[model samples]
Target: MHGPEPGPGEGMGRAVLRGGSVLAAGTLVERLARFARNVVLARIIAPDQFGLMAIVLAAIALFEALTEVGVSQAVIQNRRGHTPEFLNVAWWINVVRGVAIFAIAAPLSPLIADFYGEPALGPVLAVAFSTMVFTGLMSPKVYALQRQFRFGASVAITQGSGLLGTALTLVLGVLWQNVWALVLGTVFEAFVRFVLSFLLCPIRPTFRIDRESWRDLFAFTKGMFGLAFMTFVVAQADVFVLGRLVSAETLGLYAMAVTLAMFPLTLFSKVVQPLVVPILAAFQDTPDALRATYLRLERLIWLFGLPMAATMAVAAAPLLTLVYGPPYAAAAAPFAVIGVYTVVYMASMVSFSVYLAMARPELQRSFTLLRALLLVVSIYPLSLTYGPVGASSAMLGALVLAMVLQVANLRRIIGLRARAYLGTLGGGLVAAALVGALTAALGLLNLPVLTLAGLSVVPLLAVWGLLLFRERHEVRALRRRGGGAAASDR
Candidate 1:
């Protein structure tokens, strides 16, 4: 039921503030733990082995995307989504989707292996893909919690399970010293999430189906399924192209580089989605408020994302060498390119939550379709010629194009002011360029790895200082305009 619009004093705003902070902290912890695990594993395992694991992960992700029904989204959006009947139907759909993905993908593992020319991938894909089945059985009540904006339990469960899973990977990587360590960690993580899903959410879903609920969910999911495919292409097409055209060692290096390059974007999404998505959904009917919040978030994300993107782009080689050791140094070039791609992509993704909140999946779907088409035309030839660097460049160019289209659409639909939006983006570009130049000069000084990494933060710190100054000026303007301006800004 749509309740009365809750004000800041009524706890909704406080809940969002509190939950967003917790999710941010939790995501940071989880990412740090995973990063440490990867650093350790990279030392123990061969680049080629990591490459094989990357392919396995990509394949599993492909199947998961193919079978996505957007059940959580359906439950979150539907009127009676929290009821047992609706929850049960959604749960059952997830269960079936999971099984179907495994069934279909497992048999085709050999084909993927053959296509990639990695024989071991056949069995590896079958084993790794079983995580889908475990994930499929996760409780639908998790969505109920999300719909209610009660993120504490969800954050606790996910972060705790993620840490445990990362620990397991470290242990297994030390003992096994190969790709299976990563595979088992993936499976363990899924199983833990599946178990925690029920434990954290008290609403037990029974084995029952409701046709009406299913129809409602399907109504949302039918379009989402298509969007999922396009999303997959936008996300993993580079990996797919690189997997085919490059050596396993090269693919592995690219994977690690991309992982580091994507860290800020990943962290941004992990923190933002659980908080912002529900908030947007609640205010969807209030277009003015929604647009204001969306704009605020877009600016906030750019302010935060650009500095990190700049750091990664400029410091890719030293950062990779310092983290994963000298063996993976070749990944630096592509990593730098993809680092810029991520910030722009991150800016575009902020709008995605708005699309979902407004129930306009087709906007994002069209964006992703354009991106996928650009990739389809560009990735193969690029990968064929220039390998990972060309592939990364292509991905960057495609997103930039699609982002322009998306911005125009948002302006038409939401009265998005070009000057208002582009100001932050233009500022970000300036900050990123400054950071890049500073870090590059530092690199030329032949500093030690630890010194280089530490000194690289100097540029980022300068960016933050400038941002803080700008924020102060904005705050003063808001204060001078009186309480109503401050209220609107918030």
Candidate 2:
């Protein structure tokens, strides 16, 4: 079996364990900080205020997404990705994109605000969107770290900057008690991230352009731009559509649910997605090794994700009410549905990264386009009928369809059969079933809300322990022989 030749300190299993721990720990801390910030801010600020800020963020995301040029992906995937000329060219292109987004968004904010019937959104959006400029100026060397599997600096820059931003947001939220806290906090986080990028990487990009460099960078952007745009539409369509359909207070409740449901996905985005490209790129030349590694990762994601989905689907209402108070409990239903959606979404993410490693971003674009179209077609009608639940359901439907397309693409490209794909999900399904059964049985005891949630996950945890016990031999083998060799041996 052809396999990735693990270099010193770069065994596939070892790299995943080491890098995953850094990214996961950093992301967990950052997410917890943000969660604390939200819990505090939600109490201080009214629902309508959060709704207004959500609109502001959605508009800013739209403008920035339009200009996304896949610079980071390019830097990671290209052979000359770390060269000074290539990095410089990437910086210039991104800076130009950022400036353009700001200029257009600032002027258009008034019209966007008018559409949403919140005239105050105009200024808030203009200020929040300036983050595009800051992010554009960030050093491309951050992506270079991933290419080399060096994650410590990247995690430090991300979590350290994020913690600072969270603290600032909390301070301002206490003082202001309004939507400005959310807007300003977001802008601050971007600015800090940009500054820290330079400090950690210490690579100053000059105003230099090269034809070959531009060609290499822009080559990846073709499908990336489309994929990015489609992803934005899928990501923000619920808020964008529901803001117009429902009251601001209702929209706020829905937005809160989205945050809660997306908790798992947020970690996936920060940790797994970033690692996918560089890790998989190592096996790009060997289809068997690529497929094997991809399946193993997907299986691991499902093992955890499925149980999380089960807990969210069964216990989200009680959990939300327990943590955020009764005022936000209205978010629970949508949270439950969206939580299950996370599994499908994360599974697709693994495949998406595989496609990128193979330089087949167009495939990613195609599936995302399918999702965008589904969302656009279904969101309005669903929101009109079922309110936030319907809106969340619309997104779930769209993503499910897109994931189906992705499975088909995986088969054609890597020869991953449907049966093999289904097999990876089996353990997760069993764990999810155990959680559901345990939750159902626990409901008979008249437990307190939080206690019920706490008990509901017990079976899931046991299942995880059992799975780990079963894998002990493989774990030891990996430690002895290295991850790539051990995996290929299996």
After best superposition, candidate 2 residue 210: deviation in angstroms?
Answer: 2.5
lDDT of 2 by residue, 138-219 (tens): 8888787676556787898888889998999899999998888888888899999998988887666666678898887777
Best-fitting candidate, scored by lDDT? 2
> Cα lDDT of all candidates, in order?
0.79, 0.81
lDDT, residue 397, candidate 2? 93
Output the lDDT of residue 461, model 1.
90
Stretches > 4 Å off in candidate 1 = 1-10, 465-490
lDDT of 1 by residue, 345-420 (tens): 8778778878877766666888889999999999999889999999999999999999888877888767777776
The residue pairs found clashing in candidate 2 are none
**Model 2: number of clashes?**
0
